[model samples]
Target: MSSDVIVIGGGIAGLATAHELIRSGASVTILERSRCGLEASWAGAGILSPLLPWDYPQSVARLAQLSNSLFPEFIEALTTETGIDPEYQASGMLVLPELLPESSGDAKGLRQDARNQMAEDWCGRNAFPMTRVRSREIARALARDQEAFWLPGVCQVRNPRLLQALIRAVNLAGGKIVEHTAVAGLRVERGRTQSISTSQGDEYSADHYIVAAGPWSRQLLGEHALKLDIWPVRGQILLFKAQPGLLDTILLQEWDYFYLIPRHDGHILAGSTLEEAGFDKSPTTEARQILLAKAHALVPALTEETVSGHWAGLRPGSPANIPVIDRHPSISNLYLNSGHYRYGVTMAPGSARLLSNIILDKPQPVDVTPYQWPR
Candidate 1:
């Protein structure tokens, strides 16, 4: 059997891509090994931007910027069509840098004040909403010495709900999804993929093939004589239950790479530890302790909150953390939309739009050179 496009992987990328493809008058089919949207798409924190965009490369920043702009209308349309809210909220982010440089005259070691100034200048230049607030003013839970600032433009979504909405949107748009269907390998002849062989010995083909299988995409490509620097970077996150409004914004400890995201109705999410543990989604006690300690450090009152849950997911990592959003260099009909690492949820809509446009040969809204095949 075949369709206009066969999307391998049913996570956000696949679902969103199929949704867009269907809208563009293309028949779409998605194949998922387990369930769609249950991997990184469901487990992610869903912060709409990187915790600190300044730390990312130009490509990542550009994609995120474009995606963030599209989110408002995207969410609105999805909700209107599918009747799912996705819990989208501009909850904002508060950054608290705990570590400061020593009094050494080394230019490389930036002092606390200098770091704050640099962040402020960057936000100002970018026109992002930011404000410096005394620790005591923002949260009575923090220690006296804790310094923090607010990025009021930062936003978050409930990732599971977002995935649910995407799935509904795809189905309503006449996209076909085959669950528990694993693609064993692709049959490539000459320079184009002819068909995909499944674990159950079923063969499927399409006009074009897309590998959005997340971290597993690397193995899938390798089976076809293609090598991509994509791997699974494990991240563990802990959830806590607290009263709504107990925490005003997303609390982040900058130097520690940990964050506390607040949801409506007394739900708080704290995460995460990035480990290069090969495809292992096991939760570790040591990581839980580290996350709890960071959460308590930021909001001492959180110590009284009940520990709710802990889980891990694999993010599709790539070189320099830039996602591969281009067609396979060798295979004419094989395209890729994976290796988004930690920002898959944030980048899903933009990725889908871009991939669909590329497939349909439409003018892209953003420059495509930086995200081309990593060579």
Candidate 2:
């Protein structure tokens, strides 16, 4: 089959890109190796904020912020069109005290002072404050006080629902999705991608092609001689069935690199362990135990609830933790939208829109120079 644009992968990045291409009057087809939206996109705890850019470069921060701003309208239009709620909530995030380990006597006071200084610096620069706190005080405050200053503009999305909505919206918008069809190689000739070979022995052609295959992006672009340098970082998360009002906001324990997300339903999702164990999606008991211990320590109430589920997903991690979202240097017709690392779901809409604009030769809503392909 031939189309104006063929997008590989059916996760948020691919689906969003295909959807935007269709909106631009392009005939698009998305091919997924397995099921659509069941990879990193599905496994994400959708935290849509630019707050984690403390160590990221300015280029990444720009895209993340732009994407974060576009989410409101994107979710609204998606829900309106698909009749499926993505559950976009603005519950905010709280940094718990326990994540910041205590130091000794005078050293402890000095460390606290440094933390306060760091918080002040961030607040002055309009960044989220990363500091130390008293875990017990934090627990008591969250449990008893509803009028705390922790509730800000932090937002979240139900990833599964969002993916479903995107799939439905894509289909409704006249975009086609093919599952269990992996692109083995790209047929490039004279510096442009003309066709793609699939594992099922079928050849597909398109006017334009986009590689949004997430962690497997490099595998699909093998024939094109494009070296993406993308690797998979495995992350495992745990789910617990809890009461609705147990935790009102997303909790981040900075030092522990752990987060707790409360869903619309009475469930709390806590995670995750980042391991560089290439493409493995198996959740380890060690990770589960660690997450459970942390969760229980943070919110003692969670001890009463049973562990509902544990799963793992591979994130397409790049060296700099930013996505590659530009046209291939040698192949003019081939575009890349992979390597989003841990923020694929959060950055999908903006990345998709930017890529579509670049493909259509239209003015991008945000700058795209930072996301240009490496030469």
Candidate 3:
């Protein structure tokens, strides 16, 4: 049966958009190459914001803030619809500035003081709450006693649980989900999408089609993709089953682009190495050793024995971690909403809202110029 919209990709982007569409009174059918939510969306650490929100462009910040604001109601609705609670929490993030030590190692501290000043300025301008405090003041378990930035507005969610709830909620809302159906190509006629064909020689049609296929969006669109800068950047994460209370906050080392996120169930996720591996999701021993060294450096309790798992996922790497959430420049009935890089889950609801508004021809809350399909 044809659907009001055909979403090609069952990852967080696809699932979120379909759920939003269903909420907006549009029928949706999600076609996935494999099981939903088992991809990058599941493999993520579930941190609801960027490691350093101040480092990104204003466009990224707006989208993230919008999505973050919508998260409470989003999680509530999902929990009300499904029994799963996604474990949403205002678990703050602790930022450890990269320190540069002189030979004596006492005269020098806090590398990139200019960046910290920029961070402080940006936070003041944006009204984002942040405080400078000693690491030991907040996290007694930390190995060092350095000054850190305390961002209390940050949040976290069990992304796997969130995706599970989203899938269930969509199904309960009458949206269809078809797994293991890899969309091979789009059938376009007269500046609009007619149908999408799968590798199994079957076709699915919809009034409108969305290409949220994550890293594969540009390839799936082929010649139809005009100046869409999207590729796969592989990230590997390691899980350690440490005591839950050992770490109470999201610990981030901005210089190395590393973070350790704690869960309610005593599992701490240490990640991740952003490697330009190009679609290779295989975990490597070298990367694992590097991450373990970082985790051990901060919290000595996370040893090899406590290690539980290691896996990798390909992020839809974009130029500046900003996603396109607009209709195709020429194809009126087609849209694109991928290329969120590492912030897809963090930006899901806002991106979904933007795309749904574009589809429904409604007014947008934020400026839609930055996210327009590339000319």
Candidate 4:
């Protein structure tokens, strides 16, 4: 079918973009190779914060914070329209103190000495409410003997539920979604994308084209190759049946580079392993065990719970960890909203808004300079 805009990929980025475009009176069509929202968008744990901001670029942290601010109103409108609960919760995050070094050869003393020295270096570099605590203090807090330090602003959404809500919103908004339809190549004429050919040998054309194919964006762009350095970083998460009163807030073990998210349905989602395995979505037993051990070490109650599930997804990673959201330099009618990596779900609404502004020639809510089309 012909339309004003053809969006490739039906994950969160594509759906949100289509929703925004349609809301602005653009007739949009989404082409999904498989089921919409069943890939990275669905597999995501849905943490809305750039929890480890100290490790990311300023652009990423800014975008995440902006998106996090936009979520409340977004989810409210979505639930009102689709009657699906996005499960947006503002449950803060807790950073447990690391254990003391083992006393083998004065290691504990040496480690404390090192931290004392590093604390001086970290004084002005890090933010507030951060400190070096003894492992016994962390264990005591988990054991309810001491108070756990809280980072007040972390939040999360029910990701799979959010996708379902978006699907309903898209259909209800009069937008069309063509599932199992893979675009093999774009049909460009006179430097404009007029149509796209699917793997089934059918051609569908539109007035505008949007590529939000996540990790597969580079391949879909083909010889035209939009200078997107998007790479697939594989991450695996383990789900455990949550015990009552076990985890009240998200736990981020800063040094461990892992987190624990508590869901409304008594399930704790602990993830993830970041490996550059190149489009591989398989989960390894070793990874699972490592995650489980890490979870248990932080919250010992996890060992008593049962493993509910395990899965992996490919995050569309980039070198600078910022997404590309601009019109293609060569193809005027073509645009992109991909390479979001771990922040796709968090940045969805903001990214969609930015792309919509670009498409409609309206003023953007956030600066789109950093996410420009590659040179």
Candidate 5:
């Protein structure tokens, strides 16, 4: 099928791009190897902001900031259109740093504390309110022995529901989605993609193409030898069903690099190991144990609840953990919008908005030079 824009991959990036393009009066079609919105888009913990914003580079922070700002309106519109609540919550994040005794405020101890203090300073500089408070003030679920900082502006979404809403939004916007259809090969001619040859032995052509295939994006590009820095990093998460109000805020332990996320419906999610397992999405027992131990450490009451679910998804890891969201350097008609890694859900709206703007030659909101393909 021919269209104005053929988005390769039916994840949030592709669907959001298609939705924006359709709203701009462009005909769009999305091709997915499996069902849409079930990959990293669905499997993510859906913390709508970077787990630690100060830890990322400015390029990553810029897109994340814009996307975070855009999410409320975006999700609200999607909810209104699709009749699905994505469970968008400004639940805030409670970051627990290693506890240092008040008497021994040495340089090393202060250094560990400085990470949180730095994040608080960054939030203040950016006009976002962040407070360092005693651990017992927020929730009884956390370890009272630790020191914590609260970033109330940090939010989360139900990723699976968000994906469902996106799929419905795309459908409502008159965007065509072809599921269970893989692009076997790209037929490029004279430095341009003429059409994509599918596994079903059919050819689909479009005026322009976007590769937003997540973890598979780099592989697909390598199959066609297109230059894009994206690779698979496997992430595993554990879900525990607890009673409501068991956790009122998102709990983060920076020293351990693990988190406990509370859902509206009595489900708490403890995630994730960033493994370079080469497209393997298997959840290992080792990872499960590690996450479970961390979850219990964060909330002692969590040990009472049975594990509801554990799953893994491959994130598209990129160089410097920044996404490439610009036109392909060689192919004028091809655009790259993959390599979002852990921040896929956090950055989707801005990434899509940027890609759509680039496609339509509209003025961009932020500087695109940092996100461009390195020449």
Candidate 6:
């Protein structure tokens, strides 16, 4: 097989994996159902941190930490290979928790405040930099006057440009990307993948096969999908064209996971709702109304008039937002690298490194137990 490996899906996970494999001197090809990066990889706000890292399991945080550590060098390599800048920036994040006075009898509000305190403790133990500041101290445009947690080390990359760079880099590194080629099924003979069949009456043969199809991983795998819990989580985002520097930091609402991320070009993205609406990627009017109201409440500059775009992306929702980055137990040469519920972009490099290491039999930088296949 000239194409040593076949990657099913061309989103961040697949592209990053292909890039990693090529870097390791492996021949690789990516098969995408549509144009690359037009899905969740492009639609995301590109926050590099696990939202409230303290709230997630240790495995999630560890993987995220590894990825964050790799981002700088990874972005530099992509930019050098392709003349496109992914706009990777340490934009920081401000987490605003709704606090209640001690005199208030609201039990839910008290629990919320307690969690904020717990988050502070977690940050301390993890050696993650965090500071307490009034909302106005950082990103003075917030409409409310409240204290917030600021993680100055949090970073973000422009998801679309990053994908473009990755695609170009992969091509430069002798990797093939077959777009618009949806896989029909895998030809498994004697616990090994012999070839992959496609919907276009095409078949591809590779020494190894990886399924990184994001939310559609299970659908693509069919009966081959093991005890996988990957499902589509519909998330809608509202884009606002605002003045430059209107909001400098990523603002996250602790009560709900609603967030506002501002690009360098004054485009602020406000999202999103975690609705288990199946595989539907349609943006609902109700989501728009709710997001708009939240955006306006946070920054007075954002309103219905300033709203420029509304879009939706289906995330690969999983248990505890953990992803599977291991090989299939039944199939010897088949692997999976999907189900990164929310931090797909954030976990791209680390997950890619981990998966590629598994395939190459290279030493791992972290324990690979948490990302193992489910049975």
**Model 4: CA > 4 A from native:** 100-149
Instruction: Give a tens-digit lDDT track for model 5, residues 233-343.
Output: 999999999998998789887776688889988999998899999978989999989888888877887773568999999898988789989898888898888888889
lDDT of 2 by residue, 1-375 (tens): 898998999988999898878877898999899989999999988888643455467777677777878899999989999999999998777664332233454776577556545555654575543333343333452433221124256789999999999999899999988999998887778988879998999999988999998988887677553556788999999999987767677887655668888887878899888899987899998999999998887777776356899999999988687788998888889999988887888788889989998889989877788777765
Model 3: per-residue lDDT, tens digit, 262-350? 99999999999888988889999999999999999998899999999999999999999989998998999999989999999999999
Model 4 per-residue lDDT tens digits across residues 139-235 = 3325323223455567899999999999999999999999999999998889899889999998999888999999999989987765679989999
lDDT of each: 0.85, 0.80, 0.92, 0.83, 0.86, 0.92
Tens-digit lDDT track for model 6 on 1-375? 448899999999999999999999999999999899999999898999999999899999999999999999999999999999999999999999865666775787768768878998999998999999998899889898888888999998899999999999999988998899899998899999999988898989988999999999998888888788899998899999999899888999987988999999999999988889888999999999999999999899898889999999999999999999999999989999999989999999999999999999999999999999997
Clashing residue pairs in all predictions, respectively, total 0, 0, 0, 0, 0, 0
TM-score per model over all chains? 0.94, 0.91, 0.97, 0.89, 0.96, 0.97
After TM-score superposition, the amount by which residue 285's alpha carbon in candidate 2 deviates from its true location, in angstroms, is 0.8
lDDT of 2 at 315: 94
> How many residue pairs of model 2 clash at the backbone?
0
Q: What is the lDDT of residue 10 in candidate 6?
A: 96
Winner on lDDT (2 vs 4): 4
- Please give the RMSD of candidate 6 to the true structure: 1.3
Q: By TM-score, how accurate is candidate 5?
A: 0.96
Please report, as a residue range, the 10-residue window in candidate 2 with the lowest summed lDDT.
Answer: 141-150
Q: Candidate 2: which stretches are off by over 4 Å?
A: 97-151, 223-227
Highest lDDT scorer = 6
